[model samples]
Target: MDAVSDFDPARYLSDDLLERIRGRAAAVDAGNVFPDDDLAELRAAGYLAILVPRDLGGAGLSLAEASVLQQRLAGAAPATALAINMHLVWTGVAKVLADRGDDALRFVQEGAAAGEVFAFGISEAGNDLVLFGSDTAATPQPDGGYAFTGTKIFTSLAPVWDQLGLHGLDTTSEDAPRLVFGFVPRTDAVRTRDDWDTLGMRGTQSRTTELHDALAPANRVVRRLAPGPNPDPLVFGIFSVFELLLASVYTGIARRALDVAVETAHARTSKKTGRTYSQDPDIRWRIAEMALAYDGMLPQLEVIARAIDERADHGALWFAKLSGLKHRAVTSAKRVVDEAMLVAGGSSYFTRSELSRLYRDVLAGQFHPSDPESAHSTVAAAWLGPVDPA
Candidate 1:
């Protein structure tokens, strides 16, 4: 079989860099601390600008390339990849808009090139409405700026993000129900809580945020659209970048777990058979199953990413496709990790083992947006039509 070749993730994330991040993964997980040094190194390497246009002093890579690089990074440190995923989400959205000839988010690209970090603040406590609704209140000012009031949960990069891209419900105007999307800089109105203690992906420092009339200047206010699912370009831009990049991270986790399983199968021997576990039919079959599950995911991810980059239109089916890709990648990755643990024997059960950490880390994929239930509903509606409102 011919190898799939278009973009190599290692080109941006070199082996040496991967090793450096890998060396810190265990410690970060144990300490439940953010990967400060890792972020600095990635910043210095210009990874933060991977999706920014070349004219803006960035690497100018496409979404396909960014997805590949993220998978490679996640294989080494899932938390780092996941945390940085928030920043990349904004940049990727900018690229999507620019490709469609709407450059309203040029500030995001310019800020990224200048080394400014952007964090996502869309997720709210108990607000499964996702992009369709916002619990945060966006009050309009005479100067045209917005003062957003409310709390945001799971605010990744909380400790270090320079600007926050967020959304809120605007109830002040005659329209009265527009979802206002904008960027707010780190200032007195914004506060980050030191409450990031979690079961896994500890390095992300995804803490809770309190906003007391946090201000987004008029120029930074990007979109104000009617709340609900609509064909707005901003919605498409956000969903496409968010889902694809997220899928890439979990896919990398699967790759690493599969590698560990292979190594363990070769090294561990069966007492009665007097041979390596690799030679055992049951063990080999399990490994093959893992391989089969993981192999199917990469091509799906790559195809969707390439479609986004090439500006190909799937029209109404785009949401279902993107959500399905994310749902499948994470579920497959979790399955692969489970099989790997069994193949690696009892040694992998220890907390210090890399596979052990991955076991916990991959579980986080289930909590991300476009989750399994949501993905299934989207897909079913696309094929079978929306259920009648009786």
Candidate 2:
């Protein structure tokens, strides 16, 4: 990886680089293949080390900068951006911990600088409790390590990941229950199934993973806390970084859709009026509406990301804000893509059109963590307290 004195995403993610990535996005999606070239170029440009601290031989960028960079990357190729988000999440979490004076994940920064690819192994089938619950079994060993046995779903970068950062429930200990968080290196014990066929973002290749006695050595065990919401830094770091980065990806999609809309409007002419669609009042209004929705998302992302980077305390409200930002970004991006499809006319209906690919890609955002229901619930709970059980 190339090393730079300062973190400037625009410097690395140039218009030329973006066009190169964008050029391959359609083929990647159609073939459902991982963008090896995109990954190689990004890694070579030093993007993989954006969140690692300067001392650890990384760009040492803040979450705010990372968020902006993710948006730019996503605009070029949402699938690639979404897939890389998993790796960045781990590095972002390490940054979060280090900023709070807990250097437990310092090795993560070191590993990232050394080009170790870390995959997120949190999502599981039928586990809606997200971060508060787990079905994976974490069997404690005599040497303070853990043998994890369970299935992890939507494990992005499955084909290339070197280590998986995952969490599981430890029910064997006398304490009975604790959420065990650790990093499991790829080995024969960990099997990644060749699955991940999807309607959109196919290039992510987020396949299912089966762990049979996967081991996380004692030193790699990062945290063991109660399996529920708490003031734990681990929980905060994961939620904050994951949600922000996820939001950034969708926001980028919206920006790209808006640009497509503008270009299509200017190029297409109305036979009836003998003028470009850009001058059509109705078309202009539609573009404005897309712009209106798209504009609000980035500011919110920047605010929340900067707050996290600055270690600003919002108390319990942080959860609501973070989830809300994600919920809004995805929803708004979907709206922008929808409008752009309309602006692009019949051409966008073709499966090969970039806007069509974007249309499908934006849909996956809703299924990610902090879905609409969960986001509403979180914000409502923050404002009105939990619903009355009675």
Candidate 3:
């Protein structure tokens, strides 16, 4: 057994539930639709509020524990895990702030406990500024609340997100260019476009969301800060939790691919050698290589997650480390999937094969935030300073 199997951080998800999720994954992907059944089961299991405080009707699991659960959930159904991750990100941020004695996001925790699904509305089309800035327009009202009007892309959990945790630029206030982070309830002002046709992870239905002056009430308006990078806990919480959870999803894909490959090897017999592929040195070595790639990720994820849980204070280097971890997890998972496909042979080429789905799903990993380019940039700056401002 791998080290990951031995360490369990979250125990909310029963093995039977994961098996059911796995059973539905193929049909969900085949239909290019949301995993509604999976969502219902998870919500019923109290999985949605895993990060909210226990007193708030949640399990009150730490971020580290939630990371492990995401990995497990992703191993069964990446799309479902990915969609639910959006909600968890908000709740995780709330937990992180609460751990540090800040309760500004107590509403988020309470909402999660009350079964309100929160979706991430940060990504914008061609908006590389991600989290630091927003292309969305935020106008303040006399009552102190703000109305946001803009398009937010990749809005996961589209079919069911009760509120959107989004950011926009407030250019009308005395502060002029402050970034306003707030929540908008599902209202007439908010519209979701059913345009989530993608190569893989289709079950997520991560549609584009358009906001037409969607209102975030005064109490729900969370953070207000300057346009670019700040040391606020909300920023830190979002970045850290988002990156780690994303990494765990890809890592789970890697684990699933490797498992399928191993199973294929044992069951398949080689015509050339008149023996099982598991006995073939080449197959054994390939599986070993996949395992090796996967082995390194668990420790990094666990350590980083524990550091966040313990508030170890890595300081300025935190962003770089988080990005690097995500970068490696994605790239490594891709590599493992590639090798697993080769090991599984011709059957993996068919779209129906689990490995084929894994291959397609893994491709989506590189497209997420802290992508390869930005990740490398951050690491380079950490080591040699910011490219001499060239």
Q: Say which candidate scores most in lDDT.
A: 1
For all predicted structures, in order, the TM-scores are 0.98, 0.97, 0.97
Deviation in Å, model 3, residue 252 alpha carbon:
0.8
Write one digit per residue (lDDT tens) for candidate 3, span 1-390. Answer: 133344454458888999999999999999999999999999899999999888989988877788889988999999999999989999999988999999988988888888889999999999898999999999998898999999999999999999999999999888788999999999999999999999999998999999999999999888899988899999999999999999988999999999999999999998899999999999999999999999998999988988998998888899999999999999999999999999999999998898899899999999899989999988888888877655
What do the candidate models score in CA lDDT, each in turn?
A: 0.93, 0.92, 0.92
Give one digit per residue, the lDDT tens place, for model 2 in 85-138.
999999999999999999999988999898888999999999988898899999
The alpha-carbon deviation from the true structure for residue 373 of candidate 3, after best TM-score superposition, in angstroms, is 0.8
RMSD in angstroms between candidate 1 and the native structure over all alpha carbons: 1.4
Q: Runs in model 3 with CA error above 4 Å?
A: 1-10
Scored against the true structure, residue 73 in model 2 reaches a CA lDDT of 93
Q: Write the per-residue lDDT of candidate 1 for residues 1-390, one digit (tens) a residue.
A: 112365556667889998999999999999989899999999999999999999999999988888888888999999999999999999999999999999999999999999999999999999888999999999998999999999999999999999999999999899988999999999999999999998889999999999999999999999999999978888999999999999999999999999999999999989999999999999999999999999998889879998998999899899999999999999999999999999998999999899999999999999999878899999999999999999
lDDT for residue 306 in candidate 1, whole number 0-100:
88
